[model samples]
Target: MADPVAITAPTTVLIKVIHCIVGIMTAPLPHPTGLAYHRMGHCTGRHRWWRPLLGTLLFLGAYLVLSLVLFALSYGVGAAAGLRELPDGGHDFGPLANTALDLTSIAIALPLILLAVWWPGRRPPGTLSSVDGRLRWRWLARCLLAAVLPVAVLAVTAALLPDSGSDSGEFGAWVGWRSFLTSLAVLAVLVPVQAAAEEYVFRGWLTQAVGAFVRSPWFAVLPQAPLFAAAHGWGTTWGFLGLLVFGVVAGWLTIRTGGLEAAVALHVLNNLLGFGVAAAVVDGLSSDETAADSPWQLALADVATTLLYAALVLWLARRHQPRRLASPVASSPAPAPAPATTGRTVGHHGESGQDR
Candidate 1:
């Protein structure tokens, strides 16, 4: 058996590197904002077109570098394990390994995003999490709770649909008590981080940066949706559409609640349930054959599920009011003028002025 230490050693090193980068990038820059990005123009005090452009480039660079490192580490682990390659020259690490790889890559984005917003834009790290410069844990808990029912319903719906591809056997062969348990453990630990990191990047960092530049909330919401969809490389028309809708709705929730908590909750629930079900029933979350149905029924079911989740979250938001969106630049009181030294003293209540 391959030593677990061998796999973990590289990961530890990568994590240390990530931490060092985050520390340096997040070290207190000026022009802090507690509000969302659309209202952050005054904080940075720079409206140059290049600011957003450069900021985007910086974020991409950080993400790409970190992702490459993670990929190399994962590849090294796979090579050591003697994992076999698919016919297409891709290694099949099964569901557990794949989930770990996906989540680790996603998890790395959180600090990078904080760096992107802080270093170049001169915003505080809290601004990336919420409009109030703080993450509302209570509200996030509520949203996560509200997301459960809708996601469960979607899961049931997907299960009821017939499997249309031969890859059903693929899941069965790869999935067993041992592998399932391992995948479950990985998902339990990393899925939340993965979901939250994505929300912070798309709905939080990228949206706000664009919002800050255009000074419009819609500008923040719309452009990021396609980019989010593209990130998935869903490989089918319906899959692309489904992800696009998800992105749009998530962005909307961010704007509506003045924070990323609601969107994060919805995403966490959706991924947790989706991946959990695949791991349990299909024995794998991905397959060589596109497991989608011919008429796009399953795809539509996924879309419906996402929409239902969105509706439930929105309803909850309305019932228990979250913080309204505010300007990122908080107003500070101006200092009062100093009293003159060699001047006549002013008397109160119509008294005569006395010379000092």
Candidate 2:
């Protein structure tokens, strides 16, 4: 199979094109998610010229930074500990430590990253005017459903299963409060570094660029999902699926809410809770060499459960309004109507008319 990194860019572009085609095909119909925040005012309009380029730059920079940090930490620690005898893939690291680091980092970074995107003074910043007609309880319900449902189902199913063969990996006796807390502290530094970077690119940058340029929410949804998935690399099919679902949910939430705040909040929460839970589970268990067995069944169960969980969350959250504010068709200023007489000229600036 072609390496994911090699194909990620082309694949993401292709997905965007496919989504645009689908959106164009479906333009006449109502958007299915109970709201058309992206369609508010106009379904098609001129997009900012720099959107795609800016988004791509942000994605690349974020990825490089996070990758370097993780690599350095893992390599430096491994070398210092003289754990060359350690197993490949280093599954022996305490799950709690890994997870804690992940949660802390993401939780911290999400807010700051969003501020850069959503702050009032930023260029090309999304504004309240970009929001749908008005807030609706139904849409909120859908957001919650999409966010919570998959996780709940996965948790329940995982709880019910007997220790599967794949569950046997040892977290190593080296993990304790000090180690776990240290990892959490490191993650506290990196998770935000990672998570904020992701949301900024995928949700803030990519979603708007694709939606505006392609002229459809569905089209906007396409590019981000697979790119999000592919970034996980090959061994993590489960993680990839989780990211894809998350991308869809986050995209819809941002569109429906008419802003990125809700999606960012939900994403930060999900990452924090998910990693924390995984760490707790791993920390409580002892190291077992044979724990790593067939994970296919568990993977399937997790996927199914996650889908169910998302559905339930939607059922509980409120919906958003469907009406949209009318906006001008083009980016250029709208031409004024000719006056009845040349000397009876009237100048118009913005919404005001100078008829004095």
Q: Give me the candidate number with maximum TM-score.
A: 1
Q: Write the per-residue lDDT of candidate 2 for residues 1-356, one digit (tens) a residue.
A: 88998889898899999986554433331222332444332233323456445545664566467655765676578567764434544323455454444444434433433333332212222322235322344554454456565555566665677765454443334445665565456555555445555665566556655655566778876788777666555444555665666677667656644655445545544454444443444353233221112155555664565455444444443443433332233344556766666544445434435553
Worst 10 residues of 2 by lDDT: 285-294
Worst window of 10 by summed lDDT in candidate 1 = 287-296
Against the true structure, what is each candidate's TM-score? 0.76, 0.53
The Cα local distance difference test for each model comes to 0.72, 0.50
lDDT of 2 at 305: 53
Q: Write the per-residue lDDT of candidate 1 for residues 1-356, one digit (tens) a residue.
A: 99999999999999999997676444332354454445553444544556666777988898899888877776677778899865644466875676677778889988887776667766566767766666889989998888888778777887787764543453654456776787788898899999888888888877877777566678879988998888776566776777777788888888888788888987888778767767775545774323222126666876786688778878887899887554433345543433686464544222447622
* Highest-lDDT candidate: 1
